[model samples]
Target: MEKISYSRVWDLDKVFIGGSKSSQFLEHMNRLVALVNILESSIKSLITPLSINEVIKVVPLIENIATIRLYLSQANSFITCLLAENPRDQEAATLRGKVAQEESRFEKELSKVKKIFTYTKEDVWESMLETEKLQEYRFILNEWRENADKNLSEAEINLISDLMVDGYHAWGHFYNNLVSSINVNIQINGKEENLSVGQAINLRSHHNEEVRKEAHYVLESIWKEKEELFSKIINNIAGFRIQVNNKRGIKSILEDPLKKNRMKEKTLNTMWTVISKYKQPFSSYLERKAEMIDGTGMKAYNFWAPAIKSNRVITFEEAATLITEYFSQFGSELEGFVRKAFYEGWIETEDRPNKSAISFCAGFPLTGESRVFMTFNGTLLNMLTLVHELGHAFHNHAMKSVNGLNKRYPLSIAETASTFSEMIIFDAAMKKANSREEKIFILDEKLKRSVMNFMNIHSRFLFEQRFYKERNEGIVSANRLNQLMEESINEAYAGSLEQPSIYSWVWTPHYYITQSPFYNFPYTFGYLFALGIYAKAKEKGKDFEKDYLKLLRDSGSMSVEELVMKHLGEDITSEEFWEKGMELCVKDAEEFIELTSS
Candidate 1:
């Protein structure tokens, strides 16, 4: 109702008065450390195979630990915002390490708790869960107990947690630092200028063909120069994970990711099978895209290039207005939440140097708020990304009142809200386009997203799958890694692209994440899952909004198959469900080809 001055910089002062130097934040960390120590002591002193009375006592301790972890997460979220705002902030980085140490401490205690649950009598465990205090956490508690079967002894798990602080996780931190330090010098407008990796990557989508080509060439060269170092980082990271999984008697790397995603192997297999069958329309779309751009075929650089030249740049205010307007079309609750986020400075979109290239939405359970981080360059794609992150924020908002443990949704479903948001805006914008070029531009953007989810992400998934298999035997050479990447990309794209990104493994951050393995497939899963939900919304109209919110609320507490069955009444492990989603993509690709033909 009122005009708000949109600021690019987020307001972190309200969350913590000082950035990394905040005494309040330091005090909070100190309190968290003390609580973790208490939790560890309590877990250590607990008697196993206890009576019902002891179960009640342990439940309260679990609740306390959860509360303490929430506060720790709040601290971590604040430090993440600071680091993203200014990557060179050494103090923030130091705080991050401290937070990691505290997290390790908490996790060690949690392992002990899980051990207790693993050994507890089923009757007592069920009775404990039936108690009023533990009723809401029954799902997550049962899940933990079930997963504990896959874990090592409590002592071994604690040892792994301790070692990870300076071992596995350290490599991930090093990779981030190396990525931040990357600066490329490329000729723009006949003058050479330095660009951060984030800015250089943004140039891949530049309207000018030559600029995009140069950016790609320079980036490839830079990564190639540092390939050996990256190779070691990735090898060690994978090596550490492989050893851990081996110790746990885990047979495949996908087991961890599948369990974490609450998805079955059959569902993953079915989805890929469906995707493999539907590659023709997407290939046709790429062929048409190349024809429009006067290129012989699609190349790695041309992957993100705009189909038509348009000088229009959507500002932050305009992007926010567009998102809220489309979001309101779905539900007033989402619209109101987004407006509140905007007015409260919950998003950081400042286009500045020394910022992380990745975009994320960090939720603070302690405050029941979320912070979105991204570098906005005023393109339609950037607006869509903003909407995507806002979707995550809305999901967080939907679960704000749920128990902390139940709010830990897997990465698979996490993308549902964000991708759904993107579809809403893209669909609305397509319908409102006033010219052929505008329509093409919007459609191209939409198809670009689909290409990314289906083709690009698939390549990463394939590369990781092969790399781990080879890495199991021994260390993979940089050259071998490159070959794997290229081969995977070629296959994933179905030989559609003229040039495959061979050195992607050297620069892609997802491969190095220590917390999650195969961080690639969940994205495709989420994109397709959201498409299915969007199609349902179209069929059900405004009536679906209530059910949609309920789905978000239940996301953290159920398996992928169970959640889909309960919410959408479809079996995720079936080809019919995946085909429905793939059909939507086929329609878009067919429409794009038909339009461009004219």
Candidate 2:
């Protein structure tokens, strides 16, 4: 174990915190002013030379701008949690908030500088680093620059970016505020207590079925009453996005996200093709889950109920050893990363008062370090979270070499390494199960996730697609949104987890985040991608392991298609890649079903 302490370092660290104080903020402000002056003086040189050397200098300079903003945004993230944790720390919080604005301004200026570069695929290849180590990344760099057709005109792009902060994101903020503060009239354990929607929704995971049911009713009832308002918000936001996409000459709403994600249409199609094809295995797994509950009919509330195999509990320390040992088999580097995250005071995961009861891995974008946040109380799921966050940390470590443009990939790729890491740990544990009970527990959880990751996430993606399409035509009524959601859910989870998931809205943050529309498909994408990669690893054994690290390294560089092709020797645009991956899930489901039946 490592010694843990509180940090009041924001006001003190000039390295990361600039705008929080006059001196610190002035330092960042001065850097911005100086950067602008340098850029202005060389304006003629940039357009005139258009030399490859100029692009090199400019690219790293852009990386520097990104690095500074990344660090500052991460600093603000801590302040955000602090504000949430202690409402009384108003003065410091106010200063911290201002620094966030300064960071945003810095980002805008950096974008302006990047825009000046009339880059081409030839230029990116020409401007790249001369290293045997990274020579392979040249094609990746070239292809990315070649995709600039997707980039909108400078003025329109800037306007859209700015509008996002005040216009689109504001609605999301409103939703968060409304849900967070509103006291819902909920009857809990025979008493009517004013409960927060988030707090009430959490009850759905409780062991007491009645308590979960009541919480669901109260929360759903409240949300139902406000459905009209939420529907309007969704409609307006979707319309705004469509209008922007149309102006950009982007044919589909999905195209913008796909391009923004640096992913190819084929890779996304490959994923859906794979997911939809595997509906049978997923539904079967859900049937097994349904059998565990009483006459509840595998209702939405029951989806979260513990499967027979999920009742095991492990201490945090035990989880650390499990994850570390499992990943160590892959390589020494992964093991060391896990050790640093779990035992070196790098993670803030204790159950504390006034702390939000949610778990997330927040990267300190400046230091290339990440903090794993969760309230740990020694459950099987908690252990899984411990492994999962360490996986995220390892991913940050993986991209450390590509500290420039390749580090920020799409959300689907964002979670690939983490979930892959968890799978590594989970598989290792399942292999070690010594008894029927242990095997069933591990198998049950594993089988259940295969369904949720593929089927449930797939459905959410469908709903978002339909919702966006309908919203583009006109403002969809609240009732329409409900119908869309229900249709997608029922179609995807057909004969799986009850008619209505007590979970559809309660288990997710997607509906509330009007800013990031269609935030659901990434889960399925990452899961299937990882599963596919994992299967390949099994076939090639140690040989595949060598190239696996290479794929993770280049994840920061190329589009999803290029990366998959480079490493996996498979095209991601076709359903074939996904089909192979989905097949592995089916294999696992068969094994689990066989074990349980026997």
Candidate 3:
């Protein structure tokens, strides 16, 4: 293959011609609305304890609704891209509201379908699933049936869905807009410059200690000023969830998250138990890092600082080439897919104001393609993020041939491909390092990521768990929320940091996401799970590639436990499996300490 030219900006024109104003997009949305109306009408005509003939008729409608949802998702993804490029785009924001409205309508219809599935006779439902058109969707169909038992009446669910458009989901949208409009002025090299929240966050990993400190302080202060408003937003979001859970007779907040992840409570308990036992090595790593940086101890901002002084700037071309070349060593199919994604304008990496401080890969099922969004700053961390998102893209590619309903994987397995890709890149960089300083730099970066998955994410999970317990009683005050956050961080980190980020609850977007609750633990789950998968790949060599692809393809169709057993023959609910993953992190920390000590 010839050399491929790269562009930091992605191409959305190929998906839809005119940003948010495209006629094609408007037509697409209009058609989606029409299809949704047809689906609702068809579903409404069906009776409880569905007859075999009625079940046969509804199967086609189910497929139609799935296709409609895919189109709506594509529209949402495009609008999200537009807003990321220009957060102040009122037109794009309006389009987002339109998409949300359609989503609400479709969800109400789905609630009706769920009710029908819940009430149908067992034999009839099983026979229905055995039909030619519905066999591929048996997993999701059964999942919906099981979930329906935990929900309220169909009418009540529809009311909740309708109210949430301006209630629960509106809070999430408000938070996004507020984040985009926030900016701070800071001095850099004797000159002052204004930076958006996203831009300021990138400075947290700057090589200069003073720059990192200033950025942290300013960001914290600004978040402090807005704590009252943020407190209300978070309180209402949690309050809404708690009320709904209480109505459904759900006791613990973790129930919904665990069910959505297809994870058992025992497995979650086992993973945390294993993590708690392995915290010492990470704490020791933190102490070693503080000494290398000549600090009394590690601070919250210093967590991402480079231990050694290196200002190597990796260009977009170099990052792309390096990622693809490293990826090929594992699987040529993945390598080819990533190369196509890069050259085909499937990523948006432009560093600009008003962009969100998050990176993600959004898949479009209608087109069998994915779009990645991030602000690349030429750091090794940024390159790793690029690789991570592409891993999600590859996962999407693996499932493109499957039916849409069976392609809905949970958050636990979603991070597997991305984290695995990051590991490959880290190992490749370590082998290619030419000096002691470079090797330490590579290892330091890898350990930093491990520390985050183990400690920082653990803190978020702990804080949310406590907040929900208190929220069940009444609204939690802003000051009390801060104290809870500090308590959680101190406990999670085992008192390693000089100071905790108390106002983190005000700035972390994961807490405000209405769709996925308890988003914190999934990253930890994916990290360790991918580590286990990577270890297996090493043991099996190149022969594991086909099995790996099969695992990705089946991620959405089974429980995490069953998926692991089928692919790797391991029981995830055991401490031994989680311990194996933690052992990898322990080895990294130990190696880093030994290298730097010499």
User: lDDT scores for all predictions?
Assistant: 0.87, 0.63, 0.88
lDDT accuracy of residue 73 in candidate 3: 75
For this target, which candidate reaches the highest lDDT against the unseen true structure?
Answer: 3
In model 3, how large is the Cα lDDT of residue 468? Answer: 97
* Model 3 pairs in collision: none
Give each model a TM-score. 0.97, 0.83, 0.97
Tens digit per residue, CA lDDT, model 1, 338-446: 9999999999898867788878898888878899998888887788889999999999899887776887899999999999999899888888889887887888898
Give residue 13's lDDT in candidate 3 (0 to 100).
86
Candidate 2 structure quality by residue, lDDT tens digits, 208-298 = 6777777777667777877776676666667777887787677777876676567767667767766776788767766766766673456
Query: Candidate 2 has what TM-score?
Result: 0.83
Pull out the clashing pairs in model 1. none
- How do the residues 465-485 of candidate 3 rate in per-residue lDDT, one tens digit apiece? 999999999999999999999
Error of 3 at 147 (Å): 0.6
